[model samples]
Target: MWPLRQMLQPRHVLPIHFDNIIRINILMMQVKYCAGKNIPFFAQNGGSGWAALNLTNGIIIDILPLNKVTFNTDKTQATIGGGVSVAEAMAAGAAAGAFILTGNCDCVGALGAYLGGGYGNLMGAYGFGVDNIISFNLVNAEGELKTVTEASDPDLFWAVRGAGPNFGIVTSAVIKSYPDSNLTAWSTALVFPGEQITDVVKAVEALRPNLKPSQNVFLYLTNNNGPVILVTGFLLHATVEEGKAAFAGLYALNPVFENSGVLPYAQWNAGAASFCLREQRKPGHSVGISQLHPEQWQEIWDRYVEFRNKPGAENSVVIIEIYNLAKGRSIPSSTASWPHRDVNAQAIVIPWYTDASLDNDAIAFAQKVRNIWKSTETKSTTYINFAQGDEGLEAIYGDSLPRLQTLKRKYDPENRFNQWFNIQ
Candidate 1:
């Protein structure tokens, strides 16, 4: 067997030319183990918090090399390896004349995204990523491989759709695909004086209900030396004229910088990615709320302004993303382990700090903002995907706590795969 010392080296240093040598060494080492023995392994791709948690026990499955995905010609379904990235899946789906519900971050893993309750630009038109999955190829805690679907092992299937990672290791999944449609997406930015925060909120409140199922609107409160209001809207229209007409009302808000036109699906996604790319000044954090009341919005806005004016709060940005809930709300609450489907709106606050000295202050500020919202009767919920490592189990699970705990008892009584977003 190869020396364990060599395997302990950092994987990032492995050269492409020496990959064959490494693979051969691994193959030779495997021969020494017994046929039915189940050896623990480490699994991670992008090394984000989502993946790093798997290495907590120092034993991960290391599924990054297993990346491979295929889509059928019928456009009915596609199977993706656990390690596949959102970018990789998008390219493959485009080639196959189909697409699946995926996140905006191209680096997010397909399995990790869905298992964590994936939300994306297209979620308003489709649904949560977990809702589209048809089946899963899972390796249970006992090292037994099983194919789980609605018709077979219905309970496990339901759990896997939203609560899989907490139960077992999901090696891959087959998800429903939609026929590729050429889309016309447009973007517009309005910059109002910082003092007009109330006006901006009023505009958003008026526009929220008018948004069509095929459109998505996001508003960001930012400051680069000074405060500014920015609004971006995307439409999944079949024609440029239709997109223009659909966005006319919103555009009439008198955007300072507007770029509205037709683009291919690939271009639209790329543009979306570019707009979302922000400097990694510090450890990023966010919070979620199920609904946004007008009074709550005003209170949150006041908090944001106050926080921005504080010392060492220059680069921070507060983002607001609004998408149609018609599609997601249509699904039964029990269809998946994901809760909070019936809420009208969702909001998240993201703040940044450069120096370690300011880290505590930043966290305190975020917590204070969260507390302000929770203290009210809103009882806002948190999305597991955006959760910081320290959030409580009840906060992330919401009303589905009992069902998730029950699945934990059945599939992973020993808690072998309990690293990622663990219940206990």
Candidate 2:
């Protein structure tokens, strides 16, 4: 069989703890050793692979052991270690009767997503993962631990919130927690075959401008024979009545399939993480568009149908996330490098391929699919995790790119952290 015997494995792994700041600084100092040994070093936890399109291949540092969430005495905020997954943070905060701003997927590293303008069902309520951050334990390029906060270093703090990896290694972060006003959470998935994609797109467009702050609707389509599924989730609900109302506009389309229910917040978090990516999937190439225009939507549907016929693309998927931009904008625009706060949503094309030969075609087709939606975008902004490589500075960080470049130089002058998205 023509196959790779094994995936590219890390050559070395360095694990650190929350109590051992000295050890982390020592690991930071190891960069000198890496220089002398002529090896590249990189750090990761949870392995979400959202921070960059390319990955570091040598001397990998596994920072997954720093997985603890400790609340302050007043219980106003919770400090999470870099190794904590979304699931762990939610569990720890739930025990303390607090809700932390977290991405819906429980499997992803909490701090990495938080640093990159993390969007979630609660985004309309809490703004963004970056908005709730208070402080951090950052190891700079000089191998020194610096406590970064709004008062101590406002410029660095602002940059790190959305561009953390571009600056240094974040060992841990302190962020605020809140009370969940909605005692219950609800979600419904509506099924529509290829024939009804146009109607579904228009209906969603009609509702997009008027979507409530507590509601999030996503359009999910697989390259397989499955029908397009429009999933709507409600965060502000005590009764099914509110959830039902939130989805009434879409229900008028008379979906062929539907599933609706309520569950605990923690359960919801786990459910969302496993919703689409239930299995360990192959490395995916993805790109995002700021909004979905009607003409672009039709083109996207046509292109997706064509892509579905391609060999490996059959198992791939397209995700249209209708975000609560109105709510996300409540956070100051200057706080981070994520500049697409006013956009309505994102249309992401995820192309997954197994063999190395299929990689180029998958990425090219995925970029084409994204280009259809991008044509309709008034703004060039997109999410960090949703980006495909070659988008350039404006597309990823928008106007904030210049400021980020200065901070990158000031903090990481030699560009040790450029392995991820770089300011250069």
Candidate 3:
């Protein structure tokens, strides 16, 4: 089953025909046909999800043709097609002089990320991607198109904001956009030798409590030629000096390599383009942590170094993403189904490799890292987007499990849209 799931990914190589869904009506028709026939189906978003799926036998609905992004006249809102990638939305937002809350990566589907509690660089300032959404153009289990908004359907709207894929297929979404006529951000990439892991981790811990809403930092234990600690700090609407001051704790460490500059909003994600490469067996595991333990991170770095040296596995990366959740936390947890508002940090390990022979090795290494993270975690949880499909409902949905389950029974009794994180 694992091998079959792996083969189903990198879908281009499979000898199967897909129904290209370009319009909402067409997508609805396909859904109804598959539901009536009792044939399982999965909708392809950005084609970037690395979770293990049971697409053993199903028709793939190619929603890539639905990719479209348009902003309103005042650049205050955007109508994003379900297939739009983060890169597409970012480019469109840049052209329209607005800032859209999107994931940090470029290739992930914008709506797909939003559906799982969107965490992005701008989330500290604006809010989660789910918070920005105004309404959805959803196609339900019965293949009926429904315009869902807070005023129209509060329950389904709340469900779709966090656990959408399990309820229906959203053809398009209307999301709040901010006008950013001056859309420049300051960012720096800092590299440290593996030996500096403790100092780096401690410095990050010291800075975490002081993180401003306009600032965010990402830490990566990856192979840059060899095992190295990479840190990228970003400050929105700030000068270079301000960016430096915000991350002064890290700068005090005197990194081996440093590159800092102010970039246009369009180029904020340029550094992450390399991570967006498609079609590799990237089985990623993640956890939401309430605190950062420096000693544990040192151990993680040691383990990362050991696995990174393996042949054909140097692309594996361990990333920790931290943000100021004050704004997102300001919103009530009951407002939507996303359950990780109080989590201080999110960590993920991607065991990237293409050799089928190394599948077991990669999974072992990833699980080991996840276990290490869980050992020190006060409350074990995982962001739905970063999950690898091995978690229980409590771990993924947190306290929202009971309500989401009830909504699942109400909205999708037959469980047709169970491709991602199913409610039941």
Candidate 4:
């Protein structure tokens, strides 16, 4: 605490290790300084969809020292630092013979992803990442460091769980973990020719009703020379014997390339994260649907083909992540600002262009896909983290839009934390 007090300057410095509570207080003081003086700041981590927002003239704070994950003596729960990545958190939990909910991307910030209704392979079994969180210790707009939990401050806690960045600098959180230390899992990545894209989507949709809470599937469309091809990934938290029935329909598709095996849960969760696009800060847009009929899936495939055929769009890609919602569907919409719970899938468009003249075309292409789905969307919600551009309040927050705005007024009255998707 003494060292941090001496070092708490207004400028960003490389994070230095400090005791947990002391580090939280130091960050609270820094946030308070910024809030009190009306100086805006941005807390940067991964910045997965951060570039689309307006961050003009705000200071950036690096809070990496808070990236610690510790298990309780009895191992029912674990306290995680805000800066920890999925890879770090998963390994930490597995060390204690436990597991926690996290996204597929190993390098994505753990708390950041959880704060946005994190979707992952574990979601089918454990629900979204927010479902595992127990409490959060954050620096609010007032610069006061407060420990928030369902019992301590339900309203702020509800808002913080998924609608983060709208409130403050979350230093750490306590979350429920699963007892799957020895759980063996399976992952399958299958590639199909361009024409067979519909078969893959149909295969997934057909298996949706049979999918256990432990299974997850995602489809990817990208350029194969000139025509669009499909790549599919299937993950099951259970071993092959328990998961075989769930995968029977998928195997019938006869993919061009297939890989499936038994592996540690941690290894499957990590998946081919090396292939995740880390550096290209291109414009992207996303749309969510609970379930799409075969016709709708065909429409999405058709759109992907069109996007790939555009000039300088050779590197563009589309990823449709399927959320079986096995355990995730039972939650109340008010659980967090992320409104859609029954959504069976979400699709995102990443447009990379080499020609400056095609910038508008690229963004329009992404939005057109989103708009096409938006017209038929049963629920007016989009997953917060995967969303881009200026989607309306209803689309991002759903029925909880008004309540979140009110919470924004109560907590961040001046909206000091408005850089990243502003709640107001």
lDDT of 1 by residue, 159-194 (tens): 776666676656678987787665335544556655
**lDDT by residue for model 2 over 1-424, one digit each (tens)?**
0012124455666666456565576667776666456566676777665333333366767778878789987668999988898889888877777778788778778998899888877787778888888899987776667889999999998899888888878889999887655445777767777777777777777777777876788887763254364555554563677777777777888887787788666776654543335332333334455445665666777776676566655666677777566767877788776676766677766654465676566656777876676666665666776665567778788888898888887877777776667886
- Candidate 3 on 72-130: residue-level lDDT in tens? 88888899988889989999998888999999888889999999999998998998999
Ranking by lDDT: 3, 4, 2, 1
What TM-score goes with each of the models?
0.81, 0.89, 0.95, 0.89
Candidate with maximal TM-score: 3
Question: Which is better, 2 or 4, measured by lDDT?
Answer: 4
Task: Count clashing pairs, candidate 4.
Answer: 2
Clashes of each: 8, 0, 0, 2
**Which prediction has more favorable TM-score, 1 or 3?**
3
Worst 10-residue lDDT window, candidate 1: 1-10
Give the per-residue lDDT digits (tens) of candidate 4, residues 240-326: 655555677766777776766777766865545533554443577787876646666667677767766877677677777776685
Candidate 1 Cα misplacement greater than 4 A, ranges? 1-42, 49-57, 181-184, 223-226, 238-241, 244-249, 271-290, 294-315
Q: Once model 4 is optimally superposed onto the true structure by TM-score, how far is the C-alpha of residue 381 displaced, in angstroms? A: 1.4
